[model samples]
Target: MSRNILRHWFSVLVATLAALAISSNAFANTKNYTVTAPDGVALSVQESGNPLGQPVVLIHGLLGSRLNWDAQVGSAELQRYRIITYDLRGHGLSGKPTEAEAYRDGRRWADDLAAVIEASHASRPVLVGWSLGGAVISNYLAAYGDSQIAAAVYVDGVIELKGDQIVAHSEVYRDMISSDLKTHLDGERTFLSLCFHTQPDRPTIERLLANAAMASWDMQSAVQSMTVAASEGLSKIRVPVLLLYGEHDALVNTSGAIARAKQLDPQIQIKLYANSGHAPFMEESERFNRDLAAFIETAVIH
Candidate 1:
């Protein structure tokens, strides 16, 4: 039965469309500031690209920051729109809250996203989430609904934390929360490695490892059990949604997530990258950017 569903799904999956030639003639504006969430966690936010164009918010996954969007932010295709990226509470330049509740409650993460959108004055921006950031989008939709956003894209998103949907790397997760620094860092390195089927360049790997090291220990320990709110969030979205997944993903059960997402919202579009892994945006960037740009264009139009 599952095989049949997958076979049918593959037949109908949306492939990347012809690239959109969006000109970057306008002078792109870059801005940086801090937005304080209702709970007082200061989020580091950055904006680039046409200041007057439609907004696109790029949310990174666990242990990742705004730097994760370097490929998209720097792409000429995306430069035609206003691009926004921000670090989550426990990552990058954002405030790292020590309390367990800060990481466990899904609402706090949702509130943080809402705060960033409101603070940035992004009117009906399209939300794009990667990995754990996908869960953040789910939580945001649950708490705030789909009224504020124009569309949503989930790149290798974690649909739920269920055992079937998530690939088990027990030792890596356990060591990540270990009290010893070496053990924790080693675990983080291993976890980051699992994010790709085609490894990135040496410098990219090293920089991402450093990003992992800077994450809040408390947040890492608590986020494993964070509330996902998939039922309340995903099922309720009325706007367009695109689920982009890599077939070779090592950290997530790609087929399972796709199946679950379809069950929730059969209308949601699906796209699969056969050669890439968890981070398709980084692995097959050119194609990913084209698909994304195409989606953004269609979303903005209708």
Candidate 2:
């Protein structure tokens, strides 16, 4: 070909490449970082979506990592909100302190969450907690109060662990605190199964089991032993609260918990996933995302 013809083709190719680069950057927008807790433990954090949008920090359940919120993080419905998800200490890529005392005291949980919020540069962001994460956020309220967050969404979580409520609600709680590894692992599997009304696929089950095995058993037991009752904090919260639970949740008393939460905070809104179990976020993601957006718009941003 002539020099002129070759140059024209090269220019077109360069323009195409530039467009592809811009598209790739837009598609891969998530950023990962680490936040060091007050106890000197580093927590892995992931932030995605529009940086200037409203922030929503998500905390995972027991043995669950930031990966649990992958659906929400990547959903187009939530693209307008800055989504932040982190691995709790002793789970996933976060630091694991072998000492039982680390988990026994609830300060670390609150501090870790606070560090994440500060790292995200988010003020009064909505905090979404799943399962044990409910306890973690409750602990945060107990320590830091509700000034830092605009609202809270509890996804089949434990808001009250006082008295015999937890023990009576689920046998898995007892197994989690048990000393026998076999019993604990068995309980973990059972708990995972109960999280969904239908059983998860083989790969998902294996992945969940692997994540559960990565947790420090001692730390799990230690945290489970600690008493976390958020009744007072819930009553005192100035921001609106949203509670989401599955109708067939075997691990927690969904109806009872919602009733108790409503009694404690009249501003609380509760939603039940008719076809789901413990993990309504994953099992019924579309509805969950829609409800979440509605809640944020009406109860929080507006």
Candidate 3:
């Protein structure tokens, strides 16, 4: 085997053994804190992996907390880099505002990300955003530009929230914000279910359901109208960009998202996971981590 391939396998083996030795639910040497956004929203943030290594900020999707990045944060191959994960304004342990203005304005989301980056003292961190997280990155780039970061990776990311790019699931979205608790919970379950081609274990699903349950109803309702700065943001990024999408995605038109991203910047890299769906980072995490590590190596150098 090639030296790189041997190293990859060695890392996987070490990670596997390390996982067996530690509790499955815990991240070792994790540091947790709260970063206040520009609008006074407190974002719950966590840092794991190698603290002294290059930083990587991980932004989760709608209805997801920082826990959504457990796979990436816990990987052995990824341990060489500092990993940062945070809860969005209306998600997880973060502050949740009921007002429509807080969720409708995309700049607020971007500012929240900036606040986390600034507070963490992360120098030129690589941004890895998933699903709705992609829109957050776009808005951030539009508002602040790419001078602060090294590179970006969008995993099954949503390029735009409207038009043919988004898969139609209007009823599920409507039910998500329903006043009736059962309807709302069921909607959340269905929405999470759509994220995978092969569903996770019952325990994992239950945990994710709990995470979704913690999300704000007002935010979910208002986020539908949030602006995505694809034209302004994607076009302006001078740093390397990679789009990793699943071939079987149920929630997004992967081809359309890729097309839009390429139209904005032809230099952006693209990778498709043929057997996976909306959550390819979770569905095919080993390969995803390997690919991410390879990209970061080149990104940091550039």
Best by lDDT: 3
Error at 140, model 1, angstroms: 0.6
For each candidate in turn, the TM-score is 0.91, 0.86, 0.93
> What lDDT is obtained when candidate 3 is compared to the true structure?
0.92
Summarize candidate 1's per-residue lDDT along 185-246 as a digit string, tens digits: 99999999999989999999998998998899999999999999999998989999999999
Q: Sort all candidates by TM-score, best to worst.
A: 3, 1, 2
Candidate 1 off by > 4 Å? 1-29
Candidate 2 TM-score to native: 0.86
Candidate 2 per-residue lDDT, tens place, 208-284, comes to 89888888787777886655658657878888888998898877877678878788888788888899988988888
- In candidate 1 the C-alpha lDDT for residue 284 amounts to 94
Model 2, position 297: C-alpha lDDT score: 85
Best by TM-score: 3
Give the Cα lDDT of each candidate: 0.91, 0.83, 0.92
